[model samples]
Target: MTRREEIVDVAERLLERGGPEAVTMRRLADELGIQAPSLYKHVAGKPEIEAALQQRALQRLAAALEAAPDLPSLAAAYRRWALRHPRLYEIATRLPLARERLAPGVEAAAAAPLLRVTGGDLTAARALWGLAHGLVDLELAGRFPPGADLDAVWTHAMAARVAAGPGPGVTG
Candidate 1:
């Protein structure tokens, strides 16, 4: 891997282990067995490191969403991705990326599959996204009471959404 990719990989590891605060330049350098200045050669600073991580996380989410065979599958895929990468999920969803700061089409490309599944209904797409995110966030927080079957919960939630038939003003 390139130096930049290596740096981001270590940063992602740090993020997974201890959230964003753990990914300081010095810490990354130390982890990579290099001086802080070497990191600067590839990344401008912490913000750039964060942006790179965010971009990578978003790309993964988008890929997961795109690979779903159907709407309910999309929900399943979303949940799986978040559960597999809770820290990255938090980074991608909880931390909003200023549109102007992101590469053109990055956000749109990620949302495209969901939008298509919702039949161009942005509201429905958003609602689906919200449902998946809420469930995963709560799951990650261990908010579910003892013996609560998460798979059953997710299946029930997706079934309910599918049965709801679509939101008001959404024809499909």
Candidate 2:
């Protein structure tokens, strides 16, 4: 791996182990067997490294979405990806990249799951994306009853909406 890739790999591992707060430049340099200064040759610093991770997480998410066998199966994949990379997941969901910093088309790709369904223009597209994301977050946070799996609940909800049918589609 390139030095940049190596740095990001280490940061992601730290995130997996202890969440965002645990990922530090010193710890990353230690894990890499290189001094902290060496990281600057590759990444700007802790903040930039975290931003790199955010983009990488979105790329990983895009791959996960593409690899799913079908749309309905994606809920489980989504949860698995989130739990597997909790800090990265949190960063990916919460971090707001500076307008100039986002990799072109990455945000669009990250929101592809909802976009594929509604094919809505940007405004409606954002609304559907919010619905999908809000449902996932709320469910994961245990906002519902005990013994509940919000992922499954979300899938059922999506299925019910589709089965409910569309306007002017005719036939029951």
Candidate 3:
């Protein structure tokens, strides 16, 4: 792998182990057995590294959503993937994205699957995305009550979205 790729690979490992807070330049350099300055040779710094990871995370989520047959399946896939990589999901969705840092079309491609499933209804697509993100964030934060049947909540939410149907001006 290229040096930049190696840096990101290690950064992701750190993120998985301890969230964004743990992905320091010093730690990454340590993991890579190089001076921290060497990281700057590969990447600008933490924000650049994070932007790369965010792109990767979005690409992964888009792939998952693209494979789903319908809204319910999409919701299930989104929740499952997010739960499996909570820290990555948080980094990808929780913060304000530096859109310019992302590769051209990466953000659009990530949203394409949802827009397609929602019949290009941007509002509905956004609302669905919000719902999924909110639920996943809450679950990640351990905000749900003990024994909460989270599956049912997801099911109901998808059902509601489907029932609402596509809105006017169906263009994402």
Find the candidate with the highest TM-score and give its number. 3
Better of 2 and 3 by lDDT: 3
Candidate with more favorable, higher TM-score: 1 or 2 = 1
User: Candidate 1 has what TM-score?
Assistant: 0.85
- lDDT ranking, best first: 3, 1, 2
Model 2, total clashes: 0
- In candidate 3, what are the lDDT values of residues 1-172, reduced to their tens digit? 8999999999999999998889999999999999999889889878899898998888887887788877888888899999999888988888789898888988998898788789888888899899998999999999999899998999888888888899886854
RMSD (CA, Å), each prediction: 2.3, 4.2, 1.6
Q: List ranges where model 3 is wrong by over 4 Å.
A: none
In the range 5-100, model 1's lDDT, one tens digit per residue, is: 899999999999997788889999999999998888888788777787888888889998897778878888888888899889878877768565
Residue 56, candidate 2: Cα error in Å is 0.3
Evaluated with lDDT, which candidate comes out highest? Answer: 3
Question: What TM value does model 3 have?
Answer: 0.94
lDDT agreement of model 2 with the native = 0.70
